[model samples]
Target chain A: MATGSFATSGADLELVGIQKRFPGFTAIEHLDLVIPAGSFFALLGPSGCGKTTTLRLVAGLEDPTRGSILIGGEDVTHRKPFQRPVNTVFQSYALFPHMTVLENVAFGLRRRKMAKPLELAQEALELVELEHLASRKPTQLSGGQQQRVALARAVVNRPALLLLDEPLGALDLKLRRQMQLELKSIQEEVGLTFLHVTHDQEEAMTMADTVAVMNKGRIEQLGAPEDLYELPHTAFVANFLGQSNLFTGPVLEATSHAIAVEVAGTRVLVPKARARKHSGEVTVGIRPEKLRLLTEAPPTTAGVNTLGPGTVTDVSFSGVSTQYQVDVPGADSVTVFAQNLDFGPVVTPGTEVWVSWKVDHGFGLEDSASEEAKFAPELDTATIAVQAKRDLAAELEVS
Target chain B: MAFAAFATGTAKEQAPRRKSRIALLLLLPGILYMMLFFLVPLVSLVMTSLQAPVEFGDIGEYETAFRWENYVVAISTYGEHILRSFGYALMATIFALLFSYPLAYFIGVKARPWPLLQKLMLVMVIAPFFISFLLRTLAWKSLLSDEGFLVSSLKALSLMAPDAHFTGTGAAVVFGLTYNFIPFMTLPLYANLERLDTRLVEAGGDLYARPATTFFKVTVPLSMPGIVSGVLLTFIPAAGDYINASPQFLGGPSTAMIGNVIESNFLVTNNYPAAASLSIILMAVILVMVVVYIKRSGTEDLL
Candidate 1:
């Protein structure tokens, strides 16, 4: 909700009406952003959603087709990459193979003709806890070490802005988790603007002070991580940030306090402000973890819990939590998550159950399922993000 | 349990040994070919270089002996030719590098957005090689004749005296070497630069290196494998090339390279020991120079 109220005195990175078209494809369109100085900002989106393009534009590697790029209130749209006060830690960790780790970290300072390049480079290496590997070439280091060296290389410059394009994407799951905390601490220690672009929602949530979910060359949603997760403005954000069970319905009353909507023949009340669309039709959404499942049907109370009559279709136990899919006639399957604090009568697949959640937890969304159908053929978009995350876990098996 | 662990560990170690044995078997042909054609010839040449020439015998005959004086005699007799060969080869290698870097960079990097243009330019670079270089050098001989269009144009421009010609000059031979070996230089350079991680260069620039500084500090050093190979490909052969400096071709007596000296000693003069000694000397000098050059360039892993 608070968009432009962080770190007012320091240099803020601003993008105004930026558009970039590559030949026949438009990578970015009418994009606007304000990354407050000294705050960690993340651009989270699937591949080909313009997140990387936006990062490149900020890094001065790619000039926007139209609109301006301002770093620290200075227009650097026309400047070359070196002239801009920005640095990028590329996804591949692109540590210069030919240079020693120390030389790689010292390169930026040496280019700036700063004195005591070695000392500053050593300090930067120590920040990443990789000072001992200074004499080794980049190829000698493991993937995680290379990643930290790249981080040190970019952060050593002390640029007004540091751009990281999937900085931990190549590391193992355990290393990535460790680096996420390390990176957050490093950002805090440096007190400089860090713009991280990643497709992993957890990474964004774990590190960024603000997360902007980008899709289809535009900003789909931008807010604090919890806000975006709990009250997504669109079905895409609902599905992307985490799993959401969508129930399509017609809006019956757009009251000031709550918007009444009929879902699966059951009347549901959503917080009025949460109803992004006040029109006739809206998609009702609830997180699986927020829903409660009961074996016996309960009487529905107005302005309270909304209950849907259904039969449990599937029950899957995953150690910490048990998930259930309930088949409600005339509606999609409703999913509910139950934490295993205590065991009771197990809900079997053929048993009748009631899926209920609080009124405030249910929110209305502007129809994004139609957009999903239109862009559904790009299903690998989902698999790619999932695969990249899964690949980290798989890499741990190798080590 | 520990015995089983040791057994499995030893089995795992032996598996790679078997794999490497297969790898060595796969390399057998190459190793045999090198030993047969290259190693044998090299050893024979070194022995012949040390053989004493016919003493109070037939003019062209020689006997096998440990005549360490052959090297001294060969160096003293063909010192100018030896130095000239290396100088010309060095100049040609430098020219090839200077000219090929830009051309290769253009074809491989600049023209990357246009696949058709890249393939076309590569073909054009290679098209000249289809015609024999001997014929091309011969064509150049005519083109640089006193009355040829090139010579006439040069005369008109006053860049050359009207009576002067390019056919037999040392410049002509060096030019010939550069022209003949340009493709060798360009292709490898193109291959290396084509696969160059543009991201690394971008990273260098992002780290605040200017474009030119990046070219020297990053681009040039990264492209070193190509440079080392290209220089070796051009310089090694150019140092021992007879065709470029033969009197009938691009050069006269003053431009005689070690190859020409060897050819004359073997074919015209029929002094086989002198010819063999010169060839051995040329090979030894080139090997030393290449090792020193590769070391100086600071990339021993390239070799």
Candidate 2:
């Protein structure tokens, strides 16, 4: 659909075995990705997870140590940033401070010697709804306004792909939420391959059609947001995408359709399709929201897993949901998020409760040692998981 | 009286008042110093600029009279010297800016990855300050003398006439001024460029600007404040400099500037009124030029 003049059919971007290394560390370790034209794709990860590095490699700001980058079957690996048909909306919204908003928007067009730069820039400003602030310098505008100008500046070029490196990071919570929807709509309106890099999982889930969970310079999982949230392949993906209550156990029996795993002296069945590793040891995981917290022991139902009859250690009340931490005898403390559907007396600390979930909801992760060997050559999985958890905790605190 | 009222008032209400009193008290010494040193001398100089030579008195004697025509005589007698001084200063300022912008960019932006190199280069830029300015100018005088290695080599290479020389010329005096004020121009530019956000340059490149285009459009415009300050720092003192244009230094009598004229009038001819009027004119001209320069640069809001 011809929504506006800025709409142009975009070309797909491909990164073939790209690797980037700094002086003492490797930022990206063999990244291979292909973003389809006109798709909203997000590289979701914690800080320092190579997501931004990947974006920069595509933008031609940094050269890959070992592989080629292609845009629409053109090898642009050795080209300069200006020679490549890519533009970036930087995390700091690096608009030229000396120029007015219109001038900043027209910068790329003017550099390319395009016709009617001012008209195109004004149209782009109107697209971002900042036409009234055209004559004002960048410093005169607020952070959100500057962010819009940066977006308009990059979008006005109609590059093959648009790179957004945490573009909403500088905005407040309210403004960030508002801009997330606006950015998604703008992507659709322009129909360009938009590659967004962010640490906020919620932003990635809400804005992108496909989210690639990245960790420790590798892609942990790539799929639709719902699929990734429902069936994570690694502990990093399961814990980082959202809170996952994981239990390390050995596989007692494996069948074509299911695997019976013994977790904390209790048998839990996982669907064969959901478990990445069905034979040896595995870490079974279930989302906190999927598990139910009941005061009595759950009945022995087929195709169900129950893990508690334990004491409630803590209770936290947020507006929409109440979070309960239950301590079972065999398992460590488990987190359960209960919806605020009941108006009765809230559950207090030191009360007994049982945590239960359907077997279909459980997804199994391979043993940590093997997972570590698969991703990194030297380090173990514990260190990466702890780092990811710390980063996620810091991100949560910031939000 | 205000301090006494503050002390006697209620403690809660008078605390802010007492603090303000202390702040004013702290400013007393600076105010006294300015009044005694700057304002008093400025007023005396203005008075002297308007004074007349004593009637039928000795050469050095002058009387307190409103002879404003002393300024007219000063300008008429040394109009060419005043023009040459400004022209040399403008040339020196432009040359220093051209030399320092790249040096500062290299030191502040390119050498940033190796901070030790950045610091080392900055120290090198300011290292010439350790020697006395007069001694340095005198050294340059010898280096560009008729028989010196530079002139001799140029003559041998057929690049200059056999009888040509470097000293006793406008170019030599301008070169000396430019050399002496280079650090002044470089440091401010370095500080400004060091604080510039390099991502903006990268953004320029990402937006289809070539490297040269990015340097001109993104880097230079953002460093305008530095350019303006460096120009002022170099031009103001270069205009009033006497050492470079003194007959014993790099220049002859034909190439004398306003500073040398004022010096000779006060020392040799004992024309105190002429010297004082020329000094006042120099100050007024510099003030007007600086105001216009700052206004044209559009950095008045920064100050």
Candidate 3:
């Protein structure tokens, strides 16, 4: 994609230690972010994670409890949204219902006391490809048409920054996918800094050059999409960004480049470059795709790395891939995805399987004693009860 | 199989017939009521407007004669009163609009938890209806009198020099009309503005428009339908009201409206022909103005 070269107007937006608290609840805590003159940034999170609050703070819609917001290296923390050179496209588009498409697009221009508001509005409408619908009212147009009208209405003023708060949330899936590409292209062509907010990981991965994953009102991690996916630092990031299987065990041997951990009286080796801390017990993390399943049990256990023998409890056949649940001894059940190859019969329930993975593919983290303190005393009794319940439910469902 | 298919087709065909019969049955009472009450009275009023006056003493005068010139004589003779009626109505509408807009905007947009305020406003609007219109106008007269509480308060505040009076003037008539018609303007405006999308204003603010500009460009245009309705509501009734223009209230010959003139012609002067002609002319004028207003504003379908 050919994007217009954005001039270095000197790092247009900066947020320094912004904090927002509502009554007893804190929505954003000590948040620091900086965007260059032109950068496509995404704030990704689950619900109630304060991505929207950060955007609102940047746009000057909400005043921060602490810290300052600077635009073009000038403090604008107390300035109103209208005083700032930023515009927002809300999730609902929020086009004026009473006005024609042309009037809606011309609203900001007219408010600014421009001499030729109609001409400017026409040019904007042309930019969004809504010129033919200029005379039609908002309700007379389709959803996508209304969206374009909203876009034109904002971009007509040529603001310094554009904030899009889940603008494609209301569209159908196909329309959403189409608009994602369109929005990126438009942002590129116009050379405007876009700060987008979304909960969809795929949307952030596809559009944002840099992604910030937020959890519990704080940014857990911020990096490029592939970097965050390949090397997640925190347990929340590893779990939230994508799926990963975690194993808890004690480190029996440690070295500069590798560590051997003992799980259920069996030794497992993990690469040390990915390990965070390595003295005592540590948690090992591996992605589901890294594990391999074999039909026959291995003859010898030497040099096999980590091996688990269990029966296939359940199998799910997706169109292009298949997922199998294997119940291992003294370890949590693991989910493994396998390609649906035509060379063999499909794996089904009640089939014996061996799950094994290499040592270099796994990473370790320090074990927090808090988790053990919370669950250790009652684990022995609860595990048997949970297993019995699962068995009964499965039998009842089959019957 | 063939018999079953034929039976299904027959059943589908008969379903619509049965539904049509039920629909006709449901419509019968309304049609009958319209014929008996509305259509019959309108036809009779038009017919009576064309007939000669019923004379009490002369048999020759009792003979029926179609006299359309009575309309012209009635209008010309009471032209000032007709014009005063329209003038008062226009003034009342303008005043109501000016007073009602801020009140409606405050109640609709600024007041959170709006259902309680809406109920309170509904109570206040209906409170006037509970009291008789004649009594209310008389109350206004007393309140505006020279020795009344309002005048005394103004005198105490040094705003009035003890010689000022508000009663028996066009100002009093306009005040009374406004007091009665204000709710008619506010309720519709409140209803329309309340239903307006708040997101539109937020969007405007986000697009670098100040609050004042947003109110003018977005809020006002969106609520024009309610404004037009409120204007018509205040203007039409104010034009046809005679109680507000009665002499004992605040009106004289100069302030007498068309309704007063029509009432006098019918009751005091016993000129039925003139009264009927005046009624026809007033109705025609109101109809034409309403049609033109609807056409010009492009809000005919709002009603």
What DockQ would you assign to candidate 1? Answer: 0.47
User: What's the DockQ of model 3?
Assistant: 0.39
lDDT of 1 by residue, A21-77 (tens): 999999998899999999999999878889999999998899899999998888989
Each prediction's whole-model lDDT (CA):
0.85, 0.87, 0.77
State TM-scores per candidate.
0.90, 0.90, 0.84
Number of the candidate with higher DockQ, 2 or 3 = 2
**Chain B TM per candidate, please?**
0.89, 0.93, 0.84
- Candidate 2 lDDT over A1-399, as tens digits, reads 111233267778999999999999999988899889999999998778899999988888898999999997889999999888888999989999999999999999888878899999999999778999999999999988999899889988888788999888767888787778877877787788889998878888999999998888888889999999998888778777777888877899998999998877899899999988987788889999998888888789998899878899898988788888999887788999888886522679999988899999999886452354454432223455577789999999999
lDDT of 2: 0.87
TM-score of chain A of 2: 0.89
Interface RMSD of each: 5.6, 4.2, 5.3
Instruction: Count clashing residue pairs per candidate.
Output: 0, 0, 0
- Relative to the unseen true structure, what is the C-alpha lDDT of residue B24 in candidate 2, on a scale of 0 to 100? 84
Judge candidate 2 at residue A163 and give its lDDT.
93
